[model samples]
Target: MWHPGLVDVVYATVAGALLSTAVVAARAGSPHRTPSRTALVAAVGTLGVSFLVQSPAARGVQNHLVADLGQLTGNGTSLVAAYALRVMVLHVRYDRDTAAARARRWLVALVVAFVAMTVLFLATPTVPGRFTSPDAPAGVVAYYLIFTSYLGATLVSLALLLGRYLDTAGGRWSRLSLHLHRAACVAGLIYLAGRVVALLVGRPRLEGSGQRFNLIELGVTILMPAVVAVLFLLGVLIGRGERWLRHRRAYRRLRPLWEAARAARPHAVLPVTGGGARLRLYRRIIEIQDAQLAAAQVLDAAQRRRIDGAIAGAALTGESAAAVREAALLAAGLAVLRDGRAAGGDGGPVTGAADQEVDLSAAVARLERVSAAWTGSPVVHRLAAPPEPANPR
Candidate 1:
């Protein structure tokens, strides 16, 4: 006779937790809903179901261990099937809504209640050893059929989901999901093939009042669920990792942009060169000009107007406080623009000093030319696509 020992119990418990976690995560990540609030409740029912199969409480009074184990496993098999079906359908109808996200929550709660009640009902059945009467083979058969129906529902739901995904998402992503989707479909097919055969032939008869074929059924049962779990987890992990890595890289790139904007004062555009190079060096000139404009804004109004007019008329050069001050202004602007500081702003330009003229009119002219050139370019418009979670491998 087969026995539900420590190893079997432990494995079932752990598997229950893992499956629950995976299901909850997938649902939570769904666009339509949040995490299932009562995922633990569903897991508890699954654990209880597993435990009953592993350790039938009526082993002493009703040594019908096969019936007990078969019923429990069959029921659980069906429950899991129904869960899969619900997940698939819910995902399709889903919109990240408060109600939709609670899909598993309420259903799981009912399952827990049913499981608890079943445990109580089983504790003291009409017959001492058997949960069902010898005449109840029809009911037992019907129960198995219910589970089979759930599995069928799950298969259809998955097929629908795959079709919808292909129709909506195109290109490489379509190809990728198809890989996992096909694998999962095959796994389901394997399960259906085995279970349908078992249903038609009926559970194998035992010899000598011991489980002769229970072990065979158990082996197939464990194998199918295990394979499905592995494939599903593999797909989920890869998708999640891809999304996270892309987000991390993008954040690292943009981080410096934000930091630089905060750490220094703004300046005007200026350039060290003129002519064609001005267009190429526009970023540098813009940085310089922004700094110059900021410095001017901080100066007294009269001093600012006078210097602005002087620079407008001619360059900053000569040999006196006037020329030196204007050259200093130009130098400070260029320094801040190039090195991202206010160093040369207060010092002097490379070639000109106090009482010298440093022409900036050309820099101003370049800004307009560049602006017009940009404005004259042909405008191209395309539809905006939704952001991708991650780039395809």
Candidate 2:
């Protein structure tokens, strides 16, 4: 006996998550609009809708309306495949003029195919029931043919596109995305192929064979939705993992400066309690700013001039020179604080630039480079190191 309970619930949940995530991603990219972005989002969102409506939890009534919706949802899946193909084409060749013409041809084929499928669905005498039901009439064969062919083409195109993407993709996040895309496409193909075969072979013989091959049948029914769920969950996990890695990396790179600041001026330490990555990163930024302010009080003109001269003379150039100079200056300031002496009286307090935009990733990237030389720089050793204790007074 085939019960739809588990598969339906799983489908609904996974579909809901995929849709929600895509929506959030789209909204975040509101400033950048492109035809490819629109196609990809629509494709994904339509597939989500197809899954959502067919779920057993959503089939509240077994009336003709509900059954028609189920059938219509099948077509939605085909439409999704069409749009997915278009998305792939656009991704590979983003030329608007040429892509628009090609996309229109695809769209027209999809519409014509959809119309044919819809007409067959209405004319067919399918029992108002779950997708796996054996009560479908002869006309259902035509419906499955149209549905399966379009869906198969879409999946094939998607798989090919993902293969290309995987070849070009570098780093962890891009690899993760490609893996999920391929896995999902494979699962979709298996599910659609099974439906096509089941329809062609007729239900009575299929049910009889199911008794002998119970495990395969069970796998076919249960594993489709399960794979889809895994795909969605993997995407969410990878995204979160990427973010955590970035935050931790940034935090670690800034640690040397943060430690030095805390030692030289304890008052610069912020009263930060427990928090997530973003909050912790923010507090660390604030504390570092406070340390810079405190160091500025004792940092004198001669030391500043000397650091400037060293910066001008350093072998490094361009952005590297600028970044190294900042690190060297901060190091010198720390030394002055540590020694409790300077060539002259304190300069006025320094603070974070009010006019400058603070990009966390960019800041972290610069600091990571600076960290490579922070402890070893000769200027830092000369200026920031604590004065040796005099012979016992």
Candidate 3:
């Protein structure tokens, strides 16, 4: 009985779209970005052109042969979008640098193609008829042929690319990529076949065959591709969803253990037995896990490893790890306090200990309670990373 709100679907779709778009943006930065995303964007655009551009031009088609000249003209955009998407998907899947270059070349080919389609529609003559109107019979045929040929060419090339990719991908990535590409190809073919069917079937509506054909086309052709599009999109989303879910589940699943550690410990402050008040602080800094998730006890081991790696990689990446180190140190200081060493309020003044007014006991108590009452019931780790200077260096 619980249905998702309209906003939820919209947000999910938008997030999916954004996920694809981010790949495009990343493609711009990293040649390693998959071309499948680019193709998906284009595939959607091509279908959009049929509904958004061509369908609207339905008016006046009965009277004027070239009544919807603009609709025909708009084929240019669809051609470019579809071609790019199909080609890019192949390229990404197959690691085809040539495909990228070929994509640019084919884009130029589209202008030439449109010009040819326009000239044929304008000059060439045909008999006045029902669906094959004389205003531009040659144009229509040429357009169909060109579009069909494009589909054939694009599909074959993509199949080749996919074949090459399958041979190379070898394992998990290959399996996923293979499926994604296969679905994409099926989607492309479905749309292309639908358009082809519509043109053929729409020609005879007056004979009753036309209506039947249109109906059949709508189901068998039109919606078939739409269905394929839906499936393809779902697959993409499922892949992303699985990744997101894995991280989330891991975090949730591991959360309890982390929190249990904190719960079991009677003292929150690190038991600072030596002048090394900084030691506890250091441990806290490392265990804090970026002051966000670990303290809240929702951090997963994967996330923990990621944070650890980030810390490890900071020097290589030129990122400052001081803040993370500082949080760790603070946590460690709390640990020391629980050990009764910080009885003198931050040890009465170690070099960097008295720098801040953080309530070690209260902070840990509040945080521990939060951990105990976690709705997610995630795990937290004991802080152990060495602390940085309390004053950021």
Candidate 4:
């Protein structure tokens, strides 16, 4: 038998996950609003609110009016959520004309189901604080049948739609999100099936004729929804999560070059603050650029020629070549600064003309390569190292 406390925890967790997913999806921006995006946000938000109302603590409230209201609201909102999900999937899988035509029919069906369920809920003779029970009245049974049928059909349609999309998904995150959404749909179907079985069989009876807890029923009611909610949440956030991870990796990779530049000319580092991984990385790049400019003041023509020769001899191409060339020059500049050999000459171009014209993403890519060469490339290390002097006896 499942513990009551554990069931409550599971309910709370599912509610929280759904709510969080709704917020994340709503905040995920696009160039402009679309039917798919709007439906997705609405579906998750209503679903989350349904779970919150049906939560154990909410149901346990002392007021009978609040408890009855919660039951009706939960059922009503969940119907809306299921309808919204159907609309979302339609928009995603079909063109606007076809999707809108189909969505109107689904909307009519949703209205009929919701109205029927609400009527049954009101007609059912139930206790003041309880709407659903194992030995429910025929009206209550009819109410649940409508709820489960609508929800199950919606989940099945979503599963089919997502499965088709999964096959054509181009990106890694896109495939992963589709896979997760399909899994959530399957879980929702299982939850619906379990509810149907529970409604039919009622709770198990103990030898003493007392009510016996059913683990399968508890799992279906509590754990299954949690699984569905978490999977859906993951699907919605997978793209953002992957992008954040990529930015973080880039930020870490650029640290070596960033540190070297900042250490050579501390004053060149910017005082800007308060940003996420991507923003911090942008600021770091700007600081490194400023440091390059500061070190350029000391770098002489002879050092630039030597660095250029070393880079050309390395036979690197594309960004690799650019990075090595930049690394060599920056190393030379830092050396000149340390040796107090401040030529104060016009250092000319510290980077290739092409480098200055690249976008922020390309600049970051090149800088990441520079960071790798700053500490790892043998040619860069050899060129950057100071010349060894020989003493005659």
TM-score of 2: 0.63
- How do all models score by TM-score? 0.45, 0.63, 0.46, 0.60
Candidate lDDT values, in order:
0.44, 0.65, 0.47, 0.76
Clashes of 3: 32
Which regions of candidate 3 are displaced past 4 Å?
1-39, 42-46, 56-66, 70-74, 90-99, 124-138, 159-184, 187-221, 250-393
Find the candidate with the highest lDDT and give its number.
4
The residue ranges of model 2 lying beyond 4 angstroms of the native Cα positions read 15-46, 60-62, 66-68, 74-78, 81-110, 129-139, 168-177, 203-218, 255-323, 329-364, 379-393
lDDT of 4 by residue, 213-301 (tens): 35555676677888888898888789567767777888888888788876777767777566666667777877777767766776667
In order of TM-score, best first, we have 2, 4, 3, 1
Candidate 3 local lDDT, 257-279, one digit each (tens): 24433543434424436422223
89: Cα error in model 2, Å? 7.2
**Number of clashes in model 4?**
0
Error of 1 at 99 (Å): 8.5
By TM-score, the best candidate is 2
lDDT of 1 at 73: 56
- Lowest summed lDDT over 10 consecutive residues: which window, candidate 2? 348-357
Ten residues in a row with the worst lDDT in model 1? 379-388
